[model samples]
Target chain A: MFSITGLLTISGILFVAGAAALITRRNAVAALMGVELMLNAANLNFVAGWRYFWPERLDAHVAVLLVITVAAAEAAVGLAIILNLYRKFGTVDLEQIRLMRG
Target chain B: MTHAQLTALLPVILLAGTAVALLLVQAITRSHRVTAGVTLAGLAAALVAVTRALPQGATPVTALLTIDRFALLYTGLLALIGIGLTLLSFLYLAGRTRLTGAYYILFTLALAGGAVLASSAHFAAFFLGLEMISVSLFALAAYRRDDPAGIEAGMKYLVLAGVATAVLLFGAALLYARYGTMAFAALGTAIAPGAGDPLTLAGIALVVAGIGFKLTLAPFHLWAPDVYEGAPAPVTGFIATISKAAVFALLLRLFTQVHLREHPALFAIFATLAIASIFAGNLLGLRQMNLKRVLAYSSVANMGYLLIAFLAGGPAGAIAATFYLTAYLPALLGIFTLLTALSGRERDADAIADYAGLAWRRPVLAAAFTVLLLSLAGIPLTGGFIGKFYVALTGVSAALAGSPAFWALVGALVVGSVIGLYYYLRIVLAFFQRTPAGEEPAAITRRVPDAAAIVLTLSTLAVLWLGVLPGNTLTLISLLVEEWFR
Candidate 1:
């Protein structure tokens, strides 16, 4: 059911779309979600690549697992930072947070 | 596998263990002084480890870390800066702030991160090294929680850093995708004897851009002034010395191993950034009324000077870059520590007027500051002068004689430097500028920190010791320099 080609196609589309959303989304939370999506896409790519290219290589799976761990950490840190934005400025809008723009 | 391997790892081990030890000590002791003492002790121990490991020299636990002469030299310098900044933090924090325990922890971790960066050879190690350095900096920038400027600096750094991290990761991934490996050596193998595919080229550019951001070179240098202005002075000192040097060291590894010389476009891009950073850093610095911001811009321009050596990526070039950073670490810490001391409890004690008539009030401090500034300007007999002299000589020598890019680097250096001298001298003149009418209360003197005094002594010794007799240090550096380009 989880063919390599199918996984790769889905991951590629998700990644390209997620990246586009990250670049285009105006909402801060949406942008952050886009980041999450992008990260997940990378995770998908890793797993699919593992299955297709090196299915028996434990390190490939391990590397992807490590990235997931780091991604979770990144999300936690990013959300904490966004909490400050929500409290201070009463908006989760990335565009509005441009208060200190150079 | 070898003692050399284990020995090479001493600095890393000392730092990690000390961090754990100090954290435990603080949890139990609840004393900032104890924490500071522990932190200083740790850095000192690490410095000793670095020195002992040198002469006999070591490699890595694996190829992840490359503990050669270059790593030792830079790691030693980072330890010195860390120790100096940690000592300065005592005065900066003593009764003036809270979270001393956390502050010392972040300080030690940042130093360790820098140490890792100086020694890293693989992408995995480089990313970890950079994150270790950067994550702490995010907290350190906002160390003074009450100040909005502190928060602002922190946010800017975080967002910009996130962008840079993403870009760098994408770059690295592209390179890996093309080459099937992440090791610097493997990447070098992939690119050697032929041109890199565009994917690899783009990857290098992204890596360079990420590094360019970290180093605060032009177009990528937006964060320097604001961050420097907002962050506590000692944090600025860390940013100025360790962060910049470590990133450059990593960049040196990437370029030297990748045979970047074969790529004309990449070379031109770096050359352009160097030129732009020098001019923009100088030009923008002139308009700043804030002292920290002035130095921030000046440091950016100095990065341009370092880039000149780095661009060369040859024996003389690598030596020049490392040697200059060695000289820079001390004079740099000296000036900022002096500023931090002069500022008292107020943050950014950097308004131009704060320095007015400083010479009359604090002659010794004022004169020492002047010498340090003069060193930054590359004044004769100062370590900075020797560093800059080598950079210019190496840059001109390495650049293809008729290439526009080559001469552009030269022209930018000359012009930016001349323009730069004006702003640097402005503060010098302000020190002499007759107490700015109605004499605002004498710039409050915070109790001179004993740690600061020690750091100052260390930095001052380093400045003059090398300024007067640099032959020994230069010889030591050249061993790595030879290895770098060979």
Candidate 2:
């Protein structure tokens, strides 16, 4: 098994990069991709946690399944919105769709 | 066979059975009125089930939910709130829209989902119930399929909710890795002493972030304003009251069971988020003109207050949070329903100036608005005030016991309450503000009011009832929570 420090270092790096991509990406779809990456990085940590902590229960597997299912749902819905955004304003740039700014 | 178990399962079965039956009925008859009528009946039946189970409450349903007076009471509140929205929905869709039966289908599904969420126990059930509610909300928010805004809002919700679910799953995964179990009770064995590793802590942090999005705590609350402004008023009402309260119930349950006081880091993160949300929500709301957007921001702050209850911790925290949710549902749903009626043909009711001299023009409707506004502002003789009082007392007392984080929470709640008053009172003020003597009587083709809504407009009545008779509600809540904790 890899050292805890190694596991943590990888997770930390993945998290920062994912968050950066999510924030900086102009395309809503790209931003969504960034979010998915972030969730995956966290999943890595979750599995690592299962190995190190509750090796017997492995409940983390259940959580992983839930994340995957929800991610799919998010993709379907987000893409639908993106399609609508294109139809209406003709662009997917987050900054451009500010008409409904409250 | 236990009374608590039976009672706890009552609403779940009733709601699930009803939703399925309605879906089937829609397939067979395709009548809008019948679908809505059946949904209303199902919710009423669930309410009856809860009342019946109250006396012998506090039963654990598969260790996923605690069936006590608390869950029953919350279920009853959801039932009542659903009644108003359902009443308004049928009339509105029948009058203007074409998807009559489907509207009630989504509406009842959302209500059932909310009820299940508030009463959920284990993480599996909790997450499932929340998704069930949220997915329905997405469809309802965009029920006006022809309207681009409706469709857009639903998409945003679906996407963001997707992210949140991911975060929560990560968090839960971490917990499972550390403890080898997904049950809330099983958490202690993993973390109390030996399991309190960095992985466990990190897992909890992820879960916090995930739930935070749902709570619409600032920073993560990007979609709320747009979603609120874009969706139909009744759907917004559903989002604000039923959806928001259900999440709080989930939080309270999770924290209470997890022994939140044991996690200082989690508490600190919650404190930071709460303070940020309170200020951001209030400050941002100041510039908003759209009535729905304003309410959405208000929800962000209102959630911040509920977090204060969590910061308080223990039975007092539980009691205060529950009370606030009870008051919040009616007031929010009432305001949205009122906005719906005032919107006339168009769906947009954004400007503060739209409601000039409403008190003079529509006295009864204005009276209901006044009650909702007063309760929201925590003014005297309203449930909002009492709920605020409980939260404030609990927060301050907890802070005195050396929780500096809770002290910050108390500070945030006080300031936010003051700032929140301006916007709510602004709306109320317009009700009395006369239109410069003869100014074109502010032409508005109001949506025809529903008679069934009058039975549910207990928004005004709740304010007076809870405000004047707070002790009874408080006593019952205390008893309910006391039993739940036991």
Candidate 3:
């Protein structure tokens, strides 16, 4: 059966998994992918909430669209920054990029 | 939107238009002087627009934005600060980078975003404005692409800010699912005092954490020192001031609307964050040799102090927070401007030892630096002292009104300020120390730019004015807060 609880549970799992990936992954690109996962998980929750609770309102749809647009912009900027880092340091590993530490 | 609503949004419209104009100017002619000139004029026009619209009172432009006196006040302040930063950037970027036009474009866009944040009344607007600022910063932080440290700062900010945005969005989604409304006023009505489901409470917690990261409160503040130490000095100032002030303004508005003080558990959460940030920021700053890192940690503690006033809750608290932020701007900006002036072609002059024996070499510049540092340390006869005084007064009043938690917050404030004094004095002491025979006096030889000198002088005067004659400013802030609450 299609259920709000079921969808929410899946999103929760996705969020945690994304956070885990972000924390454990040393590669910058993979970490960005993790951020994308987390963003999608939020989008999923918005969709489920709209379907189950407030079908009369389109707030959820607008919010999801906005979130998606922001995510796209974020990805573009994130990748560009990572590319610049690669050109200078020749590595995308977060551990290796530690020139400014105490 | 009605005519009144359109008129009320004049400042924001002008800011966005200026950004687009900057791009067209860049496309036609790649002259740095012209681009910088256009940016200054645009920001000046926005400031004028804000002043003109201040009389319009509160006008809800749409479901997303509400232009009230409080919003106009902050918008005006942000534009004024924007002008100062643009001038500083013009000086900082000259001969340092060829791609100067894009920096102005991003800078104006970030200003527009801050304006949006100040006036936003809905979740959509909040998220959009925040992303605007965050994305622009990602580029601005990495503007010096050849510099490895700049790239690292940009990457760290991008990833961490992305995660924060996601967490905040999920929290918003959860609230929407529970309440079926996203408007701040409506959400306030939906959320009863001290009464919320697990999902709703969790949503609030996540949102707080997200903002905490942006504001660089404790535990979420690990990225700040690195980013501050790595990014260009002027950009760090922007991060510390404009970006932080806008977010804090939004936080105050949101919490005020939601009556967060009525929720004991949430109130306690804020208190804990405040205390932790105060101690953590002060304690961590003690060992830092880098001036940028020291300032970064100082900012963390300053935010904590601001929260003390914020948690005091009511019109007085709001007034105190706003006034504190206003006082903070000049000192912070002055220090960064001085840093930019002293920086060499290769890297920023960010070491504590760089200022050794500065007083003997440049007495005027050293005096200005001393005043600025005294302000940051909350010493008497500076704006920072008055700001801190208001915060403590509000905390005491809140405690008298029945919330004993504020006493602890006030205690933390006192302890933090005392600890903060040590590092600030260390820098001051460096300024007067005699130069060793072998060390070079290169920093002293660098000619201070006229524009930078004017900014520093004005900052020192403003700090003294706020400290000596705070009554007028206090009255102005209280009047705005009264109007807002009405």
Candidate 4:
């Protein structure tokens, strides 16, 4: 039986992995993917919470749906921004785009 | 929804409608003047709506939003600032860009997001509102596509803010799993004082981290200076004022409901963040030559100071924070208006040297800039002084009320202010210093736009008025905060 603790443990691992990827990755697109993974981990937690803990209440389900919608919107805007960065710097490397450091 | 609920939501709805209308207007005709005028009218209408709805009293429009006097006060304040920004942006964008209409639409949408944040009572509303603001800002930050620095700033903000949002969501999911509800009121009731469930504590910590990122509190403030330096002057102002203020409003509401004062561990966490932000901001600010980066650090320190009042915890603390925010907004916006007016075709005039001999070139602008800077530094005869005074008063009272920890925060406030003063005065001194022979002042290459001049004059007047006669505003805030607690 899939337990709430098991679900939370998986989500926790996913979150840490995503955070690690974000910190280590230099490519802008790869970093974006890391963010997506983190968001999806949160989504999974919401769905699992709904199924295992509170099937009567739809709050978790609603939260999951809204999170997905916002994540999609964020990804779209993020990719467009990355594309713009590429056009300007001719590469999407975060390290190479350091033009305004103090 | 009932009529009362609908009326209570009028201001946010009006802002969203205006954004949609602007989209249609852009499709038909792309006149910058017309677009800006429409935006100004919409903002004014929303401000009026907020004022009109205030008398109806606190209305919980569903579980998602609570349109109380506190929310109305901030919503109205945001709309007023939105109007000022629209006017300044019109001048800032007039000859600089071809697609100015889209800028106003994004601007209006961001304002809508801020309004929602000010009134949100549930996690879902909070998440949605936060994203609305972030998504709009990501686009707005990169609006100047030709500028590589702007694009980089946008990309950095996107990646960082995206992660922050996800962290916040995971936290919310944890809370929901624990309590089966995401409503602030419900969560507040569910989590008892001194409760130490590991899951709940982790969730709360993650949530704080997410918000700390937005507020640019220390340890989470890495992106602020670079983004502020790269974004357009006006957009940077939007980030400083509306974005920070709205999120802070939500933070205050959420934490107060959760009785943060009763949770010693959580209280200590916030206190640490506050102290770290103050020292980090001030020490880092002292070394920055770029004016924008200096202002960014100043903002970080200012938010830290504001958190002192928030940590004080009571009606008095709430009132002090609101008053301090009121006093801060004009000073920040006025400075950016000046920056926007000084920017030329090539790039923003953000270097400290750009202001050399401004007193000799434009005496009135220089004087206004000095007043705004003095206000920021909490010098006497400016609103910032009174705001700082109230915050210090709250901190002292909290210290006396058995929380000696507040003494440390109050001490940081004092030291931070002293360090803050040097940089603020350094900027002011630059305004008076003579330019070397054969080297022209770079800030005045463009004629000051009339709209920008008006905004500067108004901001200066507002700051001075708050400083000289703050009794009425203070009383008003106290009453609203008292109502909020009830």
Docking class of 3: high
lDDT of 4 by residue, A1-102 (tens): 878889889998998899988999999998999999999898888888788889998888778789888889999999999989888889998888899888
lDDT tens digits, residue span B1-486, model 4:
999988899999999999999999988899888899899999999998998888888899878999998999999988888888888788778778888988998899999999999999999999999999999998999998888888888898898789889989989888887778889988999998988998789889989999999999999999999999988888899999999999999998898888998888899999999999999999899988999999999999999999999999889999999999999999998999999899887889998889988888888888999999999999988999999999999999999998999999999999999999999989988888877766866675558878888998999999999999999999998887788777
Query: Which residue runs does candidate 1 get wrong by more than 4 Å?
Result: A1-60, A81-102, B193-196, B400-404, B436-438, B444-447
Show where candidate 4 strays beyond 4 Å.
none
lDDT of 2 by residue, B50-150 (tens): 78877774677776676666677777888888888787676657656766776776677677777777777677777777777777777777677567778
Considering summed lDDT, which 10 consecutive residues are worst modelled in model 1 chain B?
Answer: B440-449
Clashes in model 4: which pairs?
none
Report the alpha-carbon TM-score of model 1 versus the true structure. Answer: 0.90
lDDT of each: 0.76, 0.76, 0.91, 0.90
Task: Give the distance in Å from residue B355's predicted Cα in candidate 4 to where it truly belongs.
Answer: 0.2
DockQ of each: 0.26, 0.46, 0.87, 0.87
Q: Provide the TM-score of chain B versus the true chain B for each model in turn.
A: 0.95, 0.94, 0.99, 0.99
Full candidate order by DockQ, most accurate first: 4, 3, 2, 1
TM-score of chain A of each: 0.86, 0.88, 0.96, 0.93
Pairs of residues clashing in candidate 1:
none
Lowest summed lDDT window (length 10), candidate 2 chain B = B440-449
**Segments of candidate 3 deviating more than 4 angstroms:** none
Candidate 3 per-residue C-alpha lDDT over B250-339 given as tens digits, one digit per residue, 9 for 90 to 100: 998889888888788789889999999999999999989999999989999999999999999789999999999999998898999899
Residue B286 CA displacement from its true place in model 2, Å: 1.6
